[model samples]
Target: MSTAYGLTAVSLVVAATVLIGMFGLRISRTTSDFYVASRTVSPLRNASAIGGEYLSAASFLGIAGLILAYGADMLWLPVGWTGGYLVLLVLVSAPLRRSGAYTLPDFAEARLESMTVRRVTSVLAVLIGWLYLMPQLQSAGLVLRTAAGTPVWVGTVLVAVVVTINVLSGGMRSITMVQAFQYWLKLTALAVPVLFLLIAWRQDAAPGLGGDAPPTFPERTTVSIGTDVTVRVPAPVTVEVRGRVDGAGRAGPLTLTAGEHTVARDTVVTFPAGAAVPHVADLPVRTDAEWLRPLAGREYPMYATYSLILATFLGTMGLPHVLVRFYTNPDGRAARRTTVLVLGLLGAFYLLPALYGALGRIYAPELLMTGRTDAVVLTLPGRLIGGTLGDLLGALVTAGAVAAFLSTSSGLAVSVAGVIAQDLMHGGVRSFRVATLLALLVPLGLALSVRALAVADVVGLAFALAASTFCPLLVLGIWWRRLTVAGALAGLIVGGGLAGTAVAWTIIGGPPGGLAGALLAQPAAWTVPAAFAVMIGVSLITPRSVPAGVARTMVRLHTPETLAVDRGTWHPKGA
Candidate 1:
């Protein structure tokens, strides 16, 4: 990989992003323009922007890594991610746009008619936004470190600063253009490289994927461990080491037994051609046959798969960054149309990552050992076809990776900042600017402090929290008509508290394996239903707590925009 090329690509992306923000700055004279692009974004453009912001590091990098390491079962990640939008389209998109709320808190206040509910929703929105943003920041560091050999913090700080600048410059107005461009840019970057990679594969006789044997190095390979790692080797093999391994400092070939061995930080191990790749201890071990089959590939596979589906399927609607984009649409109909188009765009883009992952298994199997499976997309071109062309392709991928981080982080920052400004500050431009700083800073600090979880797993945690809390509130508030303020607040507290505890534990020190660990790791399956039940039960118990405006709110949420009915409209503070 060429650092010069990687750095150049990253620089161009940052400059272009800032330039787009400047363009938005010219048109953003009003608060509405800054907040929701004056609610005038067209369906196609808005859909493109949604695809851009929704496809984060998890989609671009993490999904490929998971596929390469975990095998067939990991396909559910892309499926669930894209299908979550379907759930959103059918359930919440149009009605949410019709609510005429500037932010989630505004929606809560309007629908529930309770300031307390608004405050609680504001806190959850900020929390979910931050949880979502943290992974984009961490994955930015991973991409930069792999592409340019930069320090981890360099990428984290760089993305944080760039996103803050973009958000503060024009907020949603500027980000819409930048993100829309980014979607195409990312699609081209991945799509073009994969075509070349496929050509390369065909030139080499198109190796078959079904094999009973585990992935093995095609040639003698040297793997450098960026961080200390414990790996599970299936069989004993002699390997040359340059650094600490198994509590011994060795520079000569040594035999490793068939078990777990710890490789110290910065260690380099050379394996003979055809040596089996060892997986990181953090990942569950599976035979090649098991890896090829769904449900058999992972521990407690059925439960884990179902939990992932539950989280992503119900979670998309609650994501603060995603929901804010719907508010940019001119009307409820445009919002629905935008969601329909987003489904197509996202579906098309997702096909490429899975291809990269499967190819990675054949071409760059050593990544499994290094536990840097997340680098599969970035490293594949360089490994499979080395030369200036490989470097160029790798740089294009690097630029796309940077775009993923920048666009998603910028959107999340804007959503978080908007909530903070509207609810916590004076709801002015200056307050938004300050809020932008806070929004980026908290997650940046967290990204630096916490050990890196798999990028997709971190995102899954955010989805679980969102699913458990906001999914219930949004669904019941819009449809049930009997949802009470007390119910919404209680649901938010109970669901958020439960899911947040699981997320914190997963981050700090994940729980030990068992039924408890399985449940904690993927909390949505249990937590989401619990949230709905609690909300419904509390609402039934406290019937008087229902908002007096429930009927009006329902009419406003459900009425077609084509009809000339007067659905109540609430303007922002200054509007």
Candidate 2:
């Protein structure tokens, strides 16, 4: 693939995003436009905007990589992610819009009638936003480094700058347009390439895509490892190498019967045509048969699968970015309608990543050895179909990848910055500019400092945290009339503390294998239930502490806007 094409594609995406932001700036003259698009967006546009911002690096790049590496078990990821919105639509969407809060903290304060709860919600919103933002930045680095052959930091900084500028221009109103445009751009980008790829696959007529054997190199191939990787090879073979291997510098052919071999950073290893690709130390190696069967290929597969399902299904409602988008709708019915359309849009977009993953397993198996599976989506175009057409397809994918990062990062920056400006600084455009800087910087630092994990896996942690903290609060505050301020605060503390600790442990200190590791890595299954239980128990105990306006608030949340009764649709100050 030509680096020029990738760079051009990325450049165009950035330019388009900024231009869209400027267009939004033309209409964004007031605070309401900055925060919630003046709550005038129709269902279809809001849904498209939501879909744009919602499909992050995890959907664009990570799902295919995980599916390529893990096969059937990883399919649950997309299923859960899509189904989570179903959970959201049925439970939170309309009532949340009815609540008339511009932000999650606003919702918290309205429901609990406590500034303390509002502050807690504000902090949790920031935490979730930053946690989600880190992986978006990291994935941007990966995409740019692959597409344009640039330094990883260059991509991260580029996304940060573009997102900050866009957010500062018009805030949510601007981003809504940018995001809605990107959603279609991304869908077309992925969908068109796959058509070409499928044609190429048919012309080649390659077999063994789902064979019983492990993946093998079809021809002599040289794989350059950008990062150090420990690979477990099944058999010994002589291989030509350049750079460090197992801490020893080697520049010539070497023979090794491998159990595990360390290929140092920047090493180029050449494998013979028929050599079986080795598995990365972090991922499980499996036969084709096992890979085709769910729960058969992974350690503690059942537990991990269920945990993943729980995390994504319950987690969607808690995301600060997602919740912020709901406020863009004009009314409760529009919110519900937006969610239904989102389900369709998201469902359609998700189908393509699985296709990419399946094709990747057949054509790009060497990624397993290099632990660069995430690059499979970018590399497949060139590998499957070479020449100018291949380069064009690759560039399209690159553009989509860039759009993914820009749309998601922009939304997160806006959400986090909104919370910070509203809660900490003055509620105005100037404070928002300051907040955007603060929001982007901390996550960029974290993205650089942390070891790169699978993008989807890291995102799952954010979901888990969201599921633990806000899922309970939203569910209880809206549905349970007896919920008290004490209950919401206690639940947020306990759930956020546990989930946050688990996140730290997984990131800073890798967890050990077995049930404990599975539990820690995917904490939502236990943590979400624990949060709900704590909130409910505490609410029951302190029933007398329920807000005096509970009846009116319930009526406001449940009543139709058409009814002349107040539905809490007042304009929010710092929302």
Quick one: best lDDT, which candidate?
Answer: 1
Writing each residue's lDDT as its tens digit, candidate 2 over 14-94 gives 999999898888898776678888887778888999999999989999999999999988999889899999999999999
* Worst ten in a row by lDDT for model 2: 566-575
Q: What shift in Å separates residue 462 of candidate 1 from its native position after superposition?
A: 0.4
What are the runs in model 2 whose C-alpha is more than 4 Å off? 567-571
What is the alpha-carbon lDDT for the whole of candidate 1? 0.90
Error of 1 at 307 (Å): 1.0
Predicted candidate 1 versus true structure: per-residue lDDT over 485-523, tens digit per residue: 888888899999999999898888976688888888899
Error of 2 at 135 (Å): 0.6
TM-score of each model, in listed order: 0.98, 0.98
